[model samples]
Structure formats: C-alpha cells, structure tokens
Target: MFAFAVGDSLVALDAVKIDTTDQARILRGGQHFQQTCLSCHSLVDFVNDPVAKELGLSKEQMPVWPEDSWNGHPPPDLSLIALSMSPDWLFTYLRTYYVDKARPTGYNNLVYPNTNMPNPFVDMQGHQVLINPNYFDKNHAHGEQFWYRVIKLKETGRLSPAEFDDYVDDIVQFLTYVSDPSVHARRQIGPWVLGYLTLFIMVTYAYFRLVGKDYFQSPKSPPPH
Candidate 1:
C-alpha cells in the first residue's frame, strides 16, 4: 500500500486536487460519515444548514451519535471547520494520521501534532509513517527534511488506496458545502435575481423615456395664483 504524508518544507498543500461537484463522491462521503465520523463529531448547526437537502439527505435518514466516549472529551462540532481550514490542510490532515505509542489515541498526525483524535478508518487506510527524516538534502536546507513516507498494511480492510482517496475528497467536499449551506441557496437563486434585474432595467428605461417626453414637447407655465 502506497500512502503519502504531506508536511515538512517540501510538501505543498495546493498539490492535492479535489472536485466538489462530484455528487456520487459527496453522497458516498455522506454514507461514510454515517458509518464512521458521526460517532465522534457532531454537526450541531445542522438545523439551519441547507446543504443536506441539496445533497438529497433527510433529517430522518441521519443519526446523531452520543458524545464521543474517547478520553472523556467531546469531539469538536464540524459545522464551520471547512470554512476555517484550507482544502489542502484538510487533505493532509485526514491522510497523515499514523500510529504513535505516546498518544492516548494511539495515533499522531504529521499536520497536527499530538492530536487526540483517532483515525476511525485506520483499518481501511492501513498504517503510515514518515520516511527517513535525517536523510541529507544539501540541495534544499540543512536542518529541514522533505516529507517522504512509507505505508505498510498488516491487514486489509474495505477500501483500496484509490477508493480511499476518493472517499476523503468527498468527505472534504461535503464538509465544505456544509460550512456555508446558504451558498447553495444563493447559487440556486442567482439566475432568477439576474433575470429580475434585467427586466427591471428595461422597464426603468421605458419609464425614463416617458418622463423625458414632456421635456422634448412644448413647455407649459402655470398662471400665478
């Protein structure tokens, strides 16, 4: 299994490509969410969120998990997370969690240090760790090492590497869409708003012409009272 841990001086967050319009991917991610992530993270602002409807989801179809039982700490709400973080940040963060002995969650992330969050899909992604951090790179910098990685799978799970990448992309897309659910509503109404403005401009132009007609015609002065 080949996996990449993105961080360090050489890794660029912009390199990860994700398409938000892939409806199938987004839906798959939603399903994955139900099965995995919902058990930890809560989408508390979901009451006003409109993206679910846009994604063809119903409230009844969704289930809210109890607060996370891990370490007695409740997981953070995911409502505005995508809005706060960059896509590349999300991309790197999701894929970078590796097994760590010191952490209570038994995992650490290259992007986020000492994070308590455990990788729920670890079985599917297998395990990943950084490559030789001390390899000499005179061409770059003396103290810094480029992000190289090696992923070894002791056991296989449901998804393959490519499928897992798509899964991550969709999850990011869904979360991003959820961040500002009103954007979908705006997108839907944008064309109608523009059409209304177009018609209004034409009507206003005609009205202006009518108002100007008296200016072109003979002027009439009223008699002094």
Candidate 2:
C-alpha cells in the first residue's frame, strides 16, 4: 500500500535570493513565460476567457503561444497563480515534472496528477523520478508505484536539479511580484527608508554638536573659578 506520510509529500522549494528589485529579473521572467509558459497558458489580456477571466487580461492582449509548438500541455493562465498558490508550491511543482513513459503523455508530475506537460527541462537535468514499490495494487499495478519520482536527462540538459530549482524560484518570485507590482515598489522603498534613518541620525548628531559648542564653551567656567 503506497501510503504517503504528511512529511513525505514534496514541499515547495525555498525561495531563491535573486534581486527581486532587479528589472532584469522581471524582464527575464516575462521572456521565459513567452518562451515556455505561453505555449499553453496566456498571461496577456487573459480576462476574456471564462476560465481565465479572473486574470484581468483581455483575450487579444493575452500572451498566447500555442502548445503544439513545444509539445506542451495547454498551460494555465498564471495571472492569479501567485495569489492562489504559494511561491514554494509553484517552485516545487515546476521542478517536479518528469518523464513517465507509461503515461499517455510520456510524463507525470508529483505536484499535479497525470499532467500532460512533459518535462521541458529534463534535457538539462538527468532524468530522475520518485519510486515507491509499495504503491502497487495488484489490479492497478502498471507503474503507479513510480509516482513521486522526478526523472531528468542523464547528461545533455543545461542545468542541475539545484540550478533548475533556482530558475523555478526566480520565475515564481517574479510572478509574485507581478501579481502586484506594488510589492516591487514597496521593496524598492526599503533602501530609501534606511537611508532616511541614517540621515536623521546624522542631522541629530550635528544639532547636538552645535548646541554643545554654545553651551559648554571651552571651559570658561573653570577659568573663572
């Protein structure tokens, strides 16, 4: 019986330390979305479609890259994904897609069940996937036991698991920021706030120095004594 413990489930990977304030990160994220995620998903003007209406994008403006181009499953609109899903969940899910020859789509995912999206990054990381021998039920025993494993390319892929994970995290963070651009502005203000505090301290110190100069003038009282 393949029973999963609470902790056994794949947790979201930790957030990466990319400069969230970097415009480059956001631009790269958008480009990556266009290249990878847009095939199935639409982020631009996503509001027209009933299913994607909540995204606030109109169909015409929605970024649309057909899935056929990349052998991808239709990607879902991600406009509100950051709001609905945690960053870690998104990061882990992105890293979890793996090849499953037994699957109709030739791929499976731990975060999503029977996903059609094949592991696009598998070529970068060696093929790998979770395996559970006990998960097999005699009647349903095709390859259910291999559920959570992540498979990747043994050699040709461009990134290692850890490196790819960071990539996913970068995308997640960028999306999180996009869902609300205010987040980016708020973060940008952080340094300014610190700078103001430093200036306040300097000004206060100067004011005290000026006061001391007038009040304690060169030991005049000691000379009189």
Candidate 3:
C-alpha cells in the first residue's frame, strides 16, 4: 500500500485535480474503457445500456468487451470504481504503470504495489521503472506519501508521454460520467421539482387562509351550548 505525494515527479497527478467535462474527451474515454477495462470487469448497468445515448456513443462504436477467459477469478465489477476511488486515483493509476519483469504480467503499479493486474494500454503509454526509493525513514513520509518520487522509462511505446496523459484523462472523465448516468438529467429536473414543491406549499397556504378552516369550523361547538 504505497501512498502518493503531491510534489512527487514520478506520480505528478494532483489529488485535488478536477475531472474533465469535455464531451469529446469523455466519449473517447468511453470507447477506450470499453476496449480495455470491460474485458475483465463487468459494468453492472450495461444491461440497461444507459451509456450509449447518454454519452452520444452508439452500441456499435462502444460495444462491450467480450467476457474474459484469461484469468480464472473474474475481476471486480467496475460500475462504481470511479465513484469509490476518486478520479485522480484512476488517472494516476492508469498512467503510472512501471515495468517489473519478475511479475507474471511484467508490470507493477506505482500507487498499488505488487498488483496482479497488467497494464492494458502498454503499447500507447510505454513502460517505466522506479529510480530513487531512499525515503524509507519512519519520520520521513507516512499514510498517503511514499519515499520514492521518480521513475525512468526503459522503453518508449506507441504514443508520446503527453499524448498518453491526455488519453488517460479522457478515460477518467468517461468513468466519472459512467458512475452516474442520470446526473445531468437530475440536475436539469432538480430546479423544476423544487419550483413545483414551492408553488404547492404557497397554494395550500393561500387556500387555508381563504376558505379552508372557516368553512369547516364545526359551528364553534354550537356556541358553547
């Protein structure tokens, strides 16, 4: 369980960074996510198919990845992965896939060490290896901060470093949207629902003042007998 630091050059992602709202990026991310992640992790909501119309992607363009036959135990469901794990975690995790030839998949994560998973986008982002891991003192760093802060790429891959970051960002954005497809509609309908409730309360109060109690007073108990 390695913790990430703010100024660490190896994992340069910010914990407080915001997710991108660009529709194009988000849509592209949905494509990549379907291509890579869905192969292992099943999205629980795909049976209803909210992703296509909501994200402006078609079923053909973003078909779900075929069921994985590579591993015996199925990977964890990813329906809420983005929500449970923040966008920064997802982004940083996606980008910091350093090479470790000893592992079965030949890759280990910077954020989560000794991980069993492989880098799905290895060709696009390339491979990296740890550099200085000297900050191992108890008082130096703890909790969410690790001593290591650098990694050097051993081999270059298809996409340049900058392009890979942008690609990962787009995927993160799509995952954030996938967590809650109804968020946009909810926001849109929220104001109207509030307005209707307010109007109902005002109308009910007006009715009470005008004729509600006066017309039904039980004749004041027959003038107190």
Candidate 4:
C-alpha cells in the first residue's frame, strides 16, 4: 500500500517556487505539448474538424484532452486546461495513470473517466493506478494508489515523491502561463500603473490648491448694499 496523505502541505509548498516566467520552462512546455499532445488535440480551432462533427461538439466540451491523438478521435484543445482544471486536480491526474488489465488500453485514470491516452511519462515518473476494493460500483468509486511497492526506476529516479511533484508543478505552471501569456506582462506592470495614478492625483491636488488658495485667502469684500 502506498503510504500517502491527502493534506500533505510539503508537496504543495514545493510547487510554489516554480518559475513560470522562465523562457526555458515555457519553451519546454510548448515542446512537450507539440511532441506528446499535438497530433490529436487542436489547441486553437477544434470545431472545424470532422471529429468535432462526429463528437457533436468541439473538444472544449470535454473536461480534458487524451494523451493519445486518435485518427478518428479529434484531440481537444488544451489552451484553457489551466483555467478549467485546478492545480491539485491537474497534479493528481498527471500522476495517476496506472496499469489496469480490465481497461481497453490496460490503463485507468482517477481524474478522467475511460481515458484513452497512455502514460507518456511512465518511464520518468513510474506507474500508478486506482485501487478501489469495489471496482464495479460507479457512484461509490474510490481514488488511486501507486505501484510504489512493485516498481522502481533504474536511473534519474533520485527525486522523491515530493521532488517529483515539483517537476509536475513546473510543467503545470508553464501551461498555466501559456494559457494567458499577457497575464505575466499585466501583473508586472500593475505596480507602475498604480504609481502613475498616485503621482497624477498628487499633482492634481497641488494644482487645485495653488489655484484656489488666493480665492479662499483673499479678504472678503464688504457686501454691496
């Protein structure tokens, strides 16, 4: 059994330092998307394709895109994945693909139902799967459990579970940033905009004081009879 806790704050903390601003990270994420996900999923315009016609709607209607890009199946656009899915959900989903003999692809997922994408990062992150005692009950389904007991990596597995989480965080952060590239620039300029507004208010106040001081200070003329 995998000894893991749900409220592990340390794992969350590791993700905080991920540099979404780094150009390298952004480039890597784009590369990863292109190499691993582009064949099936259309990031921008999915509705025009034949698959969308068959599916009755665009890929955006679905929660997430499959790892596999099928010929008949149109891959959904992932541009909005960051906004649509939570960080924790994304993190857990990325780490949850496991081998299941019963599944068509011999794999199953916790975040998604009947997923078709194979684990692209299995070699890097190792394999994990759902461990529900009552596998048949749809409503009472349980969560996943990793094969930490059986599988172990040969090399490049130095990072513990916490470290591995940071790796995923970096990727997720990069994707989130890509989802809205303008946000980074907007946030960077927010303080400057505030500073300019403050300066303008001060200058305007000074001008008003200069113009009105004489009117208030001037001795009141005697009222005309």
Candidate 5:
C-alpha cells in the first residue's frame, strides 16, 4: 500500500501587486465581476449602500448569487476570497485554467487542480493546454515541494495575453477592494495620521527639553551639604 500525500498542491503564481486604490479600475472590475462571476459566486458582505455608491453602482447593479450551489459544491461566497487566498492567487487562478479532458469541466486550473467550477472565462480566455503536465520533486519533501505547470494558449481568446492580464488584474483589484472597502478611507487618512504622530513626537521631545529639563537635570547642590 502506498500513501502519497499531495501537500499544498496549489502552486503560488507570481503576480504584480494590484492597486485597489484606483476607483475607476475597481469599478471596471466590479462591473466585469457582476457580468461574469455573479452567476455562481456571492458577495453578500460586499453588497451595501456605501459600496454601491463607491463603485458608482446602484443596488440592482450589484451582483447576486443566482443559484444555491454550482454542481455539488456551493460555489463559495467570494466576498472575502481575495483576503483569504490573496490577490495574487486570485489573479493567477483566474488566468491559469487549462484544458483537461480528464476533468469533468474539461478545464483544470494550475492554481487549483480538479476544481469543480468550470472555466467561466473560456470564451474570453480561449483554450489553453498544459505544455508538459508532469509531477516530480527532486527533494520529495513529503509533497512539500512546489508543483509548477507550464501552459500556452492553444487557441487565442477575445483578448490578447497582455489584455487578459490587465483584465484579470482589474478583477483582482475589485475583489481586494470588496474584501476590505475601508482600505480607501484608510489610505486617504494614513498620511495625516502619520504626520500627526510625527508632529506629536517632535512636540513631546521639545517640551521635554524645555519644561522637563528641570526634572531630568541634576538638582542644585542642596545647601552645599
């Protein structure tokens, strides 16, 4: 009997940091997500008056889960997925779907193998096939070694690779914003907060030098005792 534990099969793909601060970009991503991902995924926590206003969308414009579950797996609420999995992971995962005849969906993700969700962007992303789908680890550290998958577009999609990357980046940014809408406000106030703290430190040091100097200074020779 052989028991092989495939530990952390998902290979983390490198992605450039997304700018969640770009409201226009985030709005584009939100709209795109509403058109695409809303059919299966939900963002209950993200749908609010503030968020809608921030995204320049009405309540009706916000995405809703149309179905209870996708296939057997409840397509998981994606409200916090960006936070849970990271923007890089989502950005990579969305673009990494490759054709896999063995899989039920005829697509498998390099970031998430045997995923139940079908490739939603198949038309936009076109067909992709793994170059050399094999598993090997020289160290074989109990499946701890990272698994990498190489892929190339077998058929071109609506968008070119660069365009696709930008598209995916926008979506990732939107998801990141949805995960934490307060980021905008936080970023806006961060410099002010830091400035106030710096000023406070300077004022405190000066006050200590001027007023507290007496406390810190050596007392006058007491009666020359």
Candidate 6:
C-alpha cells in the first residue's frame, strides 16, 4: 500500500503546492465546486465540515443529484479524495485532461485513462490534444510516461494557463482541507504547543543546573587540609 501510494504521488512532479489555509481561495473553490461538481459528485463528509460551515458553505445550497448514478457510473464521493489520492495527483489529473473523441465523455485523463468523470474544467481550461495520438498502440502499451509527453493545449480557454492552474490549485486545496478539517486547528495551535514545550524544557534545564551544582559537584577542597 505504501509503494502503491508513493507511485501515485510520483506521477507528476510539477504539481503546485496548495495553500489550504487561504479561506478566500477555498471559498472560491467551494463555490465553483457547488456550481460544477456538486451536480454529479457529492461530498457527504464535507457537508458537515466545520471549516466549510465557517466559510458559509452549506450542502443545502447544492443542487440535488440523482440518488442512483451518473450515466451508469455512480460518481464517487470526493470528501476523502485528497487523503486517498495525494493533492499532487489530484492537481495533475485535473490539469492533464486531453481531448479524446474515442471516449463517451469526449475526454480522457493522463493520470487516469478512460476516466468516467467528464472534463469539468473544459470551458476554463480549453481543449488539450495528444501531440501524437498514433505513437502508442490502442492498448496504451507505452503507459503514463508517454502520455505526459504527448498532451498539449490546442486552444486557449477563458482562463489563461497560469490562471487555470491557480483555479485548479484552489479546488485541490479545498478538497485537501475537507480531507482533514482538523488541519486548521492543528496548524493554529502547533506553534503555541512548540513554544510551551520549549519554555518547559528551558525551565527544567535551569532548575537542573541550579540544583546539580550543589548535588553533583564535589565539595571545595578544605584549603589543602
């Protein structure tokens, strides 16, 4: 399991670091998700997330999705996605969608081939095409490494490349926060916890020094007696 997870994380090294603490950005992501993903994907755990509540996000505001499935493919709940799949993996997967008419969804992903989830950011991210669609066999025998080299943006989208990246990053950050709602409280208290430990250690050391001199030190020689 460790190696399997690590292999997934190594899929893309270019993934940008996410700042989950940015409440404003997380809010933007949450709103965008409500508009786009919530129509199909449900975040059951996130509905009761304290951080999400503080951000004024409510599941009641989301559109009701079918209880059965989405086109025979039940959309997976994404509440724990950022934990099950690394943020880097999610970020890369979202950014690496390429046009594939062969698929029913008219899209495919580099990280996950033949993904059931449609390209949610197509309008903002624009169309990406494989530079060499024929280089590999129909079976995709060449694997993921080749896919990384072949995908290229064919048309500019509403958002510039950089803007699109930031947009995706925000969404990924929001997911990450949802995975571990306690993160905000932990980060906020971490510094104070360390400070308290440091102070305790220092006081303990001072007391040790003050008492050790009398307890451990040899008595002064009695004037050469």
Error of 1 at 17 (Å): 4.1
How large is the C-alpha RMSD of every model relative to the true structure?
A: 6.9, 9.0, 6.8, 9.7, 6.6, 5.4
Model 4 Cα shift for residue 101 (angstroms): 3.4
* Backbone atom clashes (below 3 Å) for every candidate: 0, 23, 0, 2, 0, 0
Q: How many backbone clashes does candidate 4 have?
A: 2
Task: Summarize candidate 4's per-residue lDDT along 1-225 as a digit string, tens digits.
Answer: 112234321122112343556766655555555554555555564344332343344445434545453633434566666666555556656665566687767766554545666666665666554444354455532343233422233334445667666567665765676566666677679999999999999998899799978867868788999
Q: Model-by-model lDDT, in order?
A: 0.63, 0.58, 0.64, 0.55, 0.73, 0.76
Model 4 ranges off by over 4 Å: 1-42, 45-71, 102-104, 129-139, 142-160, 180-182, 220-225
lDDT of 1 by residue, 1-225 (tens): 102232342433434565555557666766676677876676767645544555445445444545555444446777777776666667657776666676787877656556667877787788765454332232544213323333234445578877877778778877776776666667789999999999999998898799968866777767779
Better by lDDT, candidate 5 or 1: 5
If the candidates were sorted by their TM-score against the true structure, best first, what order would they fall in?
6, 5, 1, 3, 4, 2
lDDT of 5 by residue, 1-225 (tens): 112112333554665587866889889888888788876676777766365566555445434543454554557777888877777668777887888888888998766767788999887889988666553223333323232336778898898988888888888888898899888778889999999999999999999999998998899878954
Choose the strongest candidate by TM-score: 6
The model with the greatest lDDT is 6
Candidate 3 structure lDDT: 0.64
The ten-residue window of minimal lDDT in model 1 covers 1-10
**Deviation (Å) of 136 in candidate 3:** 8.7
Tens digits of lDDT, candidate 3, 1-225: 223332333334445344444567667887787777765566665435445555444434433443464354345666677787778777777777777776788987766555566788778877777664442232333224431355667677898877877778877877787787677557668999999999999999999888978786776665554
Clash-forming residue pairs, model 6: none
lDDT of 1 at 203: 97
Flag regions of model 2 displaced more than 4 Å: 1-19, 45-74, 131-156, 186-225
Residue 223 error, candidate 5, Å: 31
TM-score of each: 0.68, 0.55, 0.64, 0.57, 0.69, 0.72
- For model 1, state the Cα shift of residue 185 in Å: 2.3
Off by over 4 Å in 1: 1-14, 17-25, 54-69, 130-147, 150-156, 205-225
Worst 10 residues of 5 by lDDT: 1-10
